[model samples]
Target: MNRLFNLVNQQDNRQLLMNTIRNGRVANAYLFHGPEGSGQEGFALEYAAMLNCQSRENQPCGQCPSCHKMKTLEHGNIHLVFPIRTGSLEKNDPPFKNFGPDDMEEIQNCIRKKAENPYEKLCPFDGKHIPINFIREIRRKIYLTAPEPGYKVVIVFDADLMMEPAANAFLKILEEPPDKTLLILTTSNIDAILPTIRSRCQRLHFPALSTTDLGNHLRENGIREDRINLVMRLSGGDVRQAIQLKEADLGRLREMTLEALRMIAIWKIDKVYDLVNRFVTLRKENPDEFDRLMLSISFWFRDAAILKAGKPESDLVHADMQIEIRKFVDYYTELDAFGAYSAVDNCIDLISRNVYINLALVNMFFKIHNRIQPGKSQ
Candidate 1:
């Protein structure tokens, strides 16, 4: 496939990988580390395709037999290892059943969907941690020799989420990996992963896309000039996210922010509680999405503060929220805006550190409310 195009704005990284492929000096194990939505996983897949493609080009030949199989995720030599939850492992989870053909089909479908559309609907699995059982299965696959003549490649997406048990189990294979094996692990949270596992892999950090690159990709992807700033603000230089913002309705995002801001600005405690209750419900439906929503709110507050201070809109990460931000100016002082920003920042920090979401939400609300007074510093 011409996945080099899918790279969006990561020209430097793409060039680096292309050089490595051209030289046939691929690493035995690679750790692609960066912030989420930076297209690290897509890069890994493209690299894999380039390595495994029979009819080689600067990119993968999508029409070749090997490339066709890989595009469909049916390539025998291209394997995947990821976390699988067994919260209540029974003999009935299908793949969790016998690791059978049907189970493999389901897993392949899930991964293909993820590969094709990482920013679409969340996969129906846990995102916080990769389960241990998946590691054991990976071990089993590693022992099985490649069906093709070249190398057997295993790509583990979201490797940082691997539980301790899985990490330890995989350490054995990493220490003495198969002769023909090539392992690539991609993660946004590299610090959270085990150091032992880190030591076994060649690390590559993926940088965020540049503003010009982001703008170009957005334009290429059919985003309008008027909404480009909105996508840019929400994406934080991540092209995958920019693609998402391009497709979503900003009116709804505006509505959600207005509701939250109304509750905060007016010091309506009960209404705040109701608003948080809505968040709780949203999180229950999709925890990952709830995290994104919280991020959106945080950015809005940050932008509002910047706007209050008479700074450039570009200084704020959520420039797309300006219309809503104008609403806050009439009701909030610069100090009030800063307090809201601080509260949201603290909440984000706590949540990232694995704090309970319910308490985090409530605590942020009260803190923001108490700090709303003009002279307050919290």
Candidate 2:
């Protein structure tokens, strides 16, 4: 049996799934919902491989032909689906029409990437929805007889991105899946999924990894020792984000965050303005870095809030900046500290929705400044 999945921290979930498979009572449909990077998709792939493995062992034997194919996502019985830009069709950029040769190639590439690294996040190239056309094709394919003598597994990553039409088209299959078929849907936001779909599937919840687990995983992955601490704190236990941070220019972002906080606390309007301008420029140059900067600011406020609440120092994401956080905490009431945290969160939400970078940063700066002012009440 493959031991790859044992590395994941969700022991209860793993045990339950293994029990069901051993008992030969696998559910027709399952919803794996949790925060992003909490091992939903990884578990889905592992479970799929286990179901189709030919050895009939308690877990997937990595040596079997079925297991080999499943590992590389070449198994005929496994279908992987994810959201794609419906509009890409009009541009002839990996169009969705009839799932043409180009579309098939793109889908295969995506699956291969996932097979290589189950923790890798798959996102639409441009659009937001999993179009009805894709779901329709999946529904048709699911009704067909399995090509081999094992379970057919259809795994949908980010299933919450299904549009209304596509989601409606999927209900029938979810309600009456074919014999020897398993449909697994994964999503970071459960509320975004249809109630009917949620009701039809057995829900499994995944929790964020603990700090110790995350730290160990990073070290084992050969991540630099010096950067591990910062990434660990910034990841909030999300492995994907931690991986991204490995390649990210986090030092610059940390400097910006600290400077912004220092300027805000001192009420240095000119320095804040200059900082916001630099942020706008960074957003134009590399939007991802800009987002990371905003996340850093959020963490800064979070650390201040933790200090204000008289929480243990160990709880701080920026524990290395304990002195600064302590000083910052003295400048605001607990309510204002929390208010600053909320303001940063609001800014992140707006930025995610494609709000103008300069306006969002400027407004966020002012909001944070107000909350952190020495005499502010709320």
Per-model TM against the reference: 0.74, 0.77
lDDT of each: 0.71, 0.78
Candidate 1 residue lDDT tens string, 32-151: 988777778777777777887777564686777777777766778887766654564442232265455775677667876765664332233544566666667777777887787666
**Per model, how many backbone clashes are there?**
1, 0
**Model 2: colliding residue pairs:** none
TM-score between candidate 2 and the true structure: 0.77
> Any idea what lDDT model 1 has?
0.71
lDDT of 2 at 114: 74
Q: Residue 296 deviation, candidate 2, in Å?
A: 2.6
The numbered model that scores best in lDDT is 2
Q: Candidate 1, which ten residues in sequence have the lowest lDDT sum?
A: 89-98
Model 2 ranges off by over 4 Å: 4-7, 88-95, 98-106, 224-229, 258-272, 283-288, 298-316, 319-378
